[model samples]
Target chain A: MGVKSTASNNATIFCNSKRFFRKLKEQKYLYMMVIPGIIWMLIFNYIPMYGIIIAFKDYNIISSFFEAPWAGLKHFSDFFKDDWFPIIMKNTVGISLLKLVFGFPLPIIFALFLNEIRNSTFKRTVQTISYLPHFLSWVVLGGIMITWLSESGMINELLVNMGILDKPVAFLGEPKYFWWIATISDIWKGLGWNSIIYLAAISGVDVELYESAIVDGAGRFRRMWSITLPSISGTIAILFILAVSGLLNSNFDQILVLRNSLNASSSEVIDIFVYRMGIQSARFSYATAVGLFKSVIALMLLLLANWVTRKLTGKSLF
Target chain B: MRRKFLARRTKGEVVFDIVNTIIMIVICFMMLYPVWYTLVNSLNDGTDAMLGGIYWWPRVFSLDSYKAVFADSKIFRAFGVSFFRTIIGTVVHVFFTSMVAYGLSKRYLMGRKYFMAMGTVTLFFSGGLIPTFLLYRSLGLLDRFVVYIIPAMFNFYNLLIFQAFFREIPDALEESAKIDGANDFYIFFKIIIPLSKPVLATIALFTGVYHWNDYFAGVIFINNPDLQPIQTFLYRVIAETTSVHMLQNMPAGIRTTSVTSHTIRLATMIVTTAPVICVYPFLQKYFVKGMLLGSIKG
Candidate 1:
């Protein structure tokens, strides 16, 4: 019986191998098409993931990557003990939370209001104008922001003229206002573009629902509240989950362009900190450890948000 | 029926529409004013404009800043770099990604699930900054033009979009080509590509814009000043060179110059942004459609 079972198992494995080889040969051209992308993935994506082991090592420029001495948890501990830890965490979380609070709902509200516009030309014009900022790189927009918020610029000039301020103030130069500036500018840039998803979702709603609500004596606001809002709640929920997961991302491009020596205290986030440490200061291992830390926390946040949303709304990204 | 529905609009509805329209107008102004203000300043005489209070239009219209920006060899080189990168990057990215997507679209293709799983993992995590920097360094991509093209070759999200679109193409089309003795490459380059023009344009525009706007590559990978793109050049001009300290420390005599760096800065901003703004109106519908195709689940 043992001999017979062994022979059967060997025969099954041989058959599977033969079939796999035949399948591979048949799809050789398809494999040729796909292999380049797979190679790119291995080199650019997977290799870096493997290289993340340096986060545990005491890596330096002088030493080869593999030759670097292992110092388990040292870099991470050092990062935790670093004095900039609290400040960076605060700024990262603070700016992100501010953006989430102000930036998230404005788009939905904007879309809702834009939907109510009866004139197609007027609506199209507003959308076109609004989305213009989104296409501009943060560098360009940051440059514009700097110009407009300078003491001699438009915002200050307007305020001084309107008697809102006795003097022109450099808004970006003030550390206290960095969070607000970042949050507001982020919303400004994304408001129209972000609303596109919500608007698409709203458009998909059954028009009969709105007609029925109107027939039931529901007013415009009532119809909006009951029909429009509920119809697009899935999109809202998904976006909210994404926002929560991305709480650590402080819009690194915006921060890089906007941050200066003056607002460095308020502007420094994990991403910038990592860039500074790794590239500027050449503390590669420490920066890698910090980046890994952030990535793990971000992954955790995404999973947590996905799980919670699934529990609450029966919807999840995964 | 719609006219009847419109006629039934309540007093509250009328008020809402009025308020909403006003708010939207304000929003539009808010969106447009910064760019307009920059344009006015760029076209204005630099020294005179610095005296402030020039809001709506240029107080002294002058093209000196634009002339200066154009004459500068460095800015011209940067523009060339930007133009080439956008063109080449978009073409390569579209062709390569869509080709791969074509292969993956076929369920019968061997190891399709594994390839997908590999891509899906990258969407969630990465090797972070230092390792990527080191990897690029070792790969001899640093300070090279190909760095822009190679590392950015495949975006997994874009691949998924292409795959989705490719799957919708009728299988009979490919089968007929196969029976005609046309190889996969021939079919892909001829039939598949021509039929996929809309998605191609959508992806091309996205990739082109990305290549045009990316400044981080200049900041990190490329050290050669000549290789820096226009956006990075603008970043240096606007962020680093025009710091408050420099502006404050500038000798009073320099202000007398017809084109100070300030106006030049504004001019450069407008020049860099002009292409985007010009194409925006025409490409706006495609962008909207692309955004929907990307985000909306069937």
Candidate 2:
């Protein structure tokens, strides 16, 4: 009786597998369309993920990936003990936090103020001009900025002329100014473009909310504070969560272009450290370890941020 | 008449409007002035620009810097690389990402959840730069043009965007096509492709801008000067050169008589940024729409 039942179960399994294959064959085109993407992800993303094992191994150019001897936690420990580790972390967190604190809110304010503008032509023109900087590469902007912040450049000239400085000052040459420069420049590049999302949210707000508020004698400021703010709170929350997760990411391209020997103390963020160690110095294993550490921390931060936002505002990225 | 009456502003509101308008003007000036200053400097005689009081216009008007920039064969080659890469990369990315998005959008597709989970994992974590570089090296992608195209072909964010857009498309349209004996590929090519023009254009612009502006890939992957994109070329010219060193490495065949390194660098900056600035005005709405779509939970 047991043998007979097992045979029937095997027959049913075979029948189910045949039906699945038939369904798959019928929708073969869908499979064909998705296959390229799956293959790409495996080759580009998954392989790299697998290659991250080098962080645990004593990887070198001379040895094949599998042949590399295990180093366990040696590379990670070395990174923590590295002389530049503290400085790198400081700069990364400093610049990223500065941008978050100052750079994040300016866009929401910009969007709100932009929404207040009554004239369409003026509004469109302002928006067009504002977003122009975002499209330009940091290479171009950095080149322009290097000249503008030089001792003899426009910024120094303006400051000196306005009695803000006694003499020309080299803005980029000073390590003290690097964080501010990075943050401000990031804001300048992103302000209008960043505001686009907020503006979209504002446009979606019900017109009747404003009308009813006005009828209730609420001023524009009150309406904006109570109505528009709450309307787009979800967007703000999501973006803030994203910002929190990216706390370690200083703008690599911007920093790389702007950094010189004089500003190295303040400009050496984790991304730069990784680039220098891995690509420049060819300390691949150590760099991979450092990068892995950052990735793990970033993932944890993202999950934590998502959890907090969900708990506080009932909004989550997932 | 009632609407007009209701639109009347209070004294405080009037003051607020004035303040807001002034603020907007200042912001606009702040945004425009740097590029304007760069343009002025680029157009100025290089030696004269060193005197450093030229704020609004080129005091000694000359096109020598631009002339010098245009004269370089390397710059032209780099520009060609940038152009072709942006076009080809955008095309391949839009096609591949949208194809996958459409397939994934089908709720009944086999192993759909697993496929989505695979794509979703990429969003939060990546195998850091060194591993990626190593993987690319092993794949023989380093220093090759296709390195730009293949690795960038499937962005998960873009796939999500396309999936959201594709799902909004009426099932009836696709069902009708299927009833006519059309397969998924044929319907996607014939019907869906035509319908998805806005999203396609939006994604295309985004991917194009990214490719054009990216100097990191060129800096890390491609060592060959001939393969470097224009932005990378500009980065090299700007980052490596001081005024003193510029004289040594000034483009071999050009007369640097009226052009200094600073002015030439500004010219290079202008040239690199010109394509984006020129196209931005017309494409502004689409970019805003793209941002909005991206912000949505896809």
Native contacts retained per candidate?
0.77, 0.81
User: Once superposed on the true structure, which residue ranges of model 1 sit more than 4 Å away at CA?
Assistant: A1-15, B242-256
CAPRI tier of model 1: medium
Q: Write the per-residue lDDT of candidate 1 for residues B1-298, one digit (tens) a residue.
A: 7789999788888998999999999999999988998899989998988887888899999998888888888889999999999999998999899999888888877778899999999988999888999999998999999999989888888888888788778989989999998877888888889998878888998999899999999899999999999998888777775455435322233344677777888888899999988988888888888888887532
Encode model 2's per-residue lDDT on B197-279: one tens digit a residue. Answer: 98998999999999999999999999999999999998887766633333455565565568887787888889889998899
The 10 consecutive residues of candidate 1 chain A with the worst lDDT sum are A1-10
**What would the per-residue lDDT of candidate 2 be over residues A14-124, giving only the tens digit for each residue?**
777886888799889999999888998988888888889999999998786789999999999899999999999999999999999999999999999999888889998
Report chain B TM per candidate.
Answer: 0.95, 0.96
Query: Top lDDT: which candidate number?
Result: 2
User: Tens-digit lDDT track for model 1 on A1-318?
Assistant: 585457557677677788678768878888899999999999999988988999999998878789999999999999999999999999999999999999999999999989989999999999999998888999999998898788878889889989999998888889999999999999999999999999889889998998888889998788778999989988988898889989998788899989998888999999999999999999999999999999999999999998999999988787
